[model samples]
Target chain A: MAKFSGVWATFEYLDEMSHAVEKIREKGKKPTVLSPCPRHEIDHALGEPQTRLPFISLFAGMLGCLTGYSFTAWTASDWVLPVSGKPIVAIPPFTIIGFELTILFTALFTLAGMVLLGVIDTLRHPLPPAVKKYTRFQRDRFGVVVDCDPAQTQDFEEIFKSYGAEEVHIENN
Target chain B: MSGTTFTYGKINDDMLRMLERPHPSYFLLLLGFLTALGLGVLSLAVQVNVGIGYSGINHPIAWGVYITNFVFWIGIGHAGTLISAVFYLTRAPWRTAIYRAAEAMTVFAVMTAGLFPLLHTGRPWLAYWLIPYPNQRMLWVNFKSPLAWDVFAVSTYMTVSILFFMIGLIPDIAILRDEAIRKGQKLRAMIFTPLSLFWRGTNYQWMHYMRAYLIYAAIATPLVFSVHSIVSWDFAMSSIPGWHTTIFAPYFVAGAIFSGLAMVMTVLIPVRVVFGLEDYITDHVVQSVCRVIIFTSIIVGYAYATEFFIGWYSGSPFEKAIFYFRPFGLMEEWTLTGEQSIGFPQIAFFLMVFCNVIAPIPLWRWKIRNNLVAVWIICGLINVGMWFERFNIVGSSLQREFLPAAWGSYWPTVVEFGITVGSFGFFFTLFSLFVKALPPMAIMELKEAAHPPMKKEAHG
Candidate 1:
């Protein structure tokens, strides 16, 4: 089992949360921030790199386009039903299916990418017990969970309280 | 501080309260919708058992009310994707308040629209034949046909719309899961937890979620244009006089958006009132949508005029005959009484023009557009008008074809009407359930848009 301990602090304001996150990081501890909505200031403070979901969508879209066109062409040729005296391999009309499937697959891949990546990222750093204590983190509250040594918990708690934390809790896992 | 009157906690409380508190009116309305849906199922059953002959469609006018309703519902679905996906891609902030319900409308409307083709097939049980799978018969789908394209387009649109809707719901569902956990609703928490994909609002999750949403938005934009264009081609690809025009694509698209915005208004107005979401949905949002309605209505009106002008200018007797017969049916002679003399097609044509054109003109005034009651009534008119427009196009054109001998009038049987009513009931029922279950407004998005509070001055 993954073992860790931390101090979770709930902030009423984004600026306060941002300050607390910076303070935790300055002390060389990894801090996780949670808020009801995505905040630019908090994100910048966390310094997480951009996700590769767009590239995944693009690759999936290209595959979808190829599959759409090739499947239609292969199927048409397999059962060579000449339609209305037109060519057996109709590229023009087949493009519609290709276009639609490209969008469909891109959307599907994007959803898959987001969910898989999100779930993996979350599982890697399990929810800290401190964060769990305040359900408002998923609602209105902005929170920072600092992974710190048990001996330093008091110092972190003072830092969070000075930064206008509404509540602070300690949890070990 | 965000300029919003609501705090994040307040939003959670307000939204979750809707689920916990069930007003008597909700049950009563649900009962009404369910009854309507039951009646629709009964009508469909009658058609299935007694044969599609129970419908008014026959001979030349083979596509009647069913096709009309199909196009109408499909058109209604367009505004949702347009407002949600297109507006999001363009970074329009106003979409935040309205897109959740609009996206839901897209899903339900498409669901309702998908049923018509099956219902019209006379043998709905074999509807699977429309799909192209490797079969022992060694036959392949005719990819050249617009009908085939329609199958692909509609299915793709439905899948993508549903995915987009579901993805947007994840964050809100996580909030609900948290709320349920706090309130000791274990069953609700159990259900919502997995659905939320264990969202913890971490920076990594937000990064991926935002990127995926942008990609989905980008892909969905073209889909809004293509699906209806393909649907229009189901008629335009034919050799039929009125349906064969090149203008059909743009005309259909504009009309689709026009009617779709109207439907969004129709659905949102009552929802805004019932849920008391006026502060978020706002009169400004309603007016902004009205502006879109006005623009699309003009395009539709122009398409209408161009169709008539082109018919008269083309000098083709067949085209002229169809165009003329639409507003003034079989002008050669009428021995019937005064009321009967004005035929069904003529009445449908006039109503289409009046509802689609004349009724929406009032939206030009800020006074009329700002009033919820007026907007609702106007949107209802546009909805009726758009249905008649489809009816006129499908019924009027086919009723009087190339040869006069083949010309015959058509009207929908009671079964067709019941099924149409049921489609509305079905749409409303799904919407009602959605409102009660999910946050009608996007809670996170609204919270994001709100103005943050100003920081207090630093103490000496």
Candidate 2:
């Protein structure tokens, strides 16, 4: 993650996250770039692709509509006999319940999906040393982590410096 | 004391401190509540022991006190939506001081309004039968009936009101959560717990919340228009001469808002003074609302003329005679109260016109509109006049409904009169309590009112 920060990384380093895999191939270590609400072409820069939300919400909403409509219709028709000549399964009357249930399920599922996605409810992320040093991501600084702790003496710094690296902050993970 | 300086938020804190202790204002309010509550208790006792006959609703007008109070309180409820949404949209700064109380007024007045149709029902226990649900009795209510429409209209309106109120309370609940953490206040935390719903104040949560609230507001806009339109349709759909008119949908909506704004102005002027919120609720806000008042005043005037023209143009003898009887028909033939009935009850006629139409003309002239004294008096007149308009429309119209044999009248009985006043007390009592518990304004809106929009966020 530190390998993807902008503040810790130089212009050449910015190009590393921009052209993340290229630098990763150069470094002999692969890296992944992330975009929740994309800054723009960041995914394209990293060559990763994705789509919005789960198809499950649409299915849930459809199911809810059918359930609501059928319940209202059944109750009016089969469950009780008509006193007058009025139709037992009046679709117009059941439309209200159907519409309300559709919106309700869509809203409920979207909220559940966000929680499951770990968007904001990051309750227990332990702070790694490198991530702690780069907590400036919370504010204005955007720098990419090179994944090399530098403490490893893993020769990663040499590989990073080769990519026009301005400065390297070791991530103590 | 008359010309002292104070901060806006500071006034609430100071008032709270005084209120927490034994202050004169607190004692006065408490006394007022107790007195009104006593009246309510006594009235309820009579109502429970006796019957609906205790009310002034009899003969030609089977709806009197309860209905009058119903319109009055529902009109009161209108002011809340205006304060919360309308004034917010218009950038009325004065809304800060009064919006919360007005919303509270909305909830309590709705409660009061909900009671009327039930109270009007002689056997109140059978009221739940109005809900169109399956039952063992194998009975179904008429879906086409206006009363059924009223049931749906009121139910939908109340639901929307509650949603609007709860959404507005979310940020304030967060504020309380923060305060509770700082002070380790048990009561504060308990109140905030459910309302906060584990809000983390994260940017994502705020974005979602903002989107939901905006969607609800957009949804509520039409609900506000339709709910009142349906309520008005209750009368217009009927065959009661003056009540039956195509103009009513708009006319009733206009009248409701017209009366609603006047009520807001009256309530705010005194409230701003007591709460010392002059800076936030400035003369500009009053004038802004008065602008709406003036526009609607003209519409109401046009409605009056349009009704008369409609009667004359259509040449419906019944409609024509109803209008003619209002101002010129013989007293021997047409009945009204007292010798005042002789030449049209000029008092009732002029009172409605003067208050609804004429009282707001000075608003077109900027100086008088902005003048606090003049504006307050006019607001008072508007309140009086709007009530009289309803009385004339409901009372006078129903009193004569085309059939001479069914042409008796109405006056409020003691129980009916007491309950009406009690409802006012109920509304204000809730409003006062809300002021102490919550930030009276939408803080975000107030902040926006002070500043311009921010640039869109970029994750980078």
DockQ for every prediction shown: 0.69, 0.07
- Candidate 2 per-residue lDDT over residues B74-116, each given as its tens digit: 7667767766766556655566555666676677777778887
Q: What is the TM-score of chain A, computed separately for every candidate?
A: 0.89, 0.61
Best by lDDT: 1
Name the runs in model 1 displaced over 4 angstroms.
A27-30, A148-155, B1-5, B332-341, B453-460
Which run of 10 residues does model 2 chain B get worst, by summed lDDT? B450-459
TM-score of each: 0.95, 0.72
lDDT per residue, candidate 1, B326-372, as tens digits?
88886653436655466677778989999999999999999998999
Which candidate has the top score in TM-score? 1
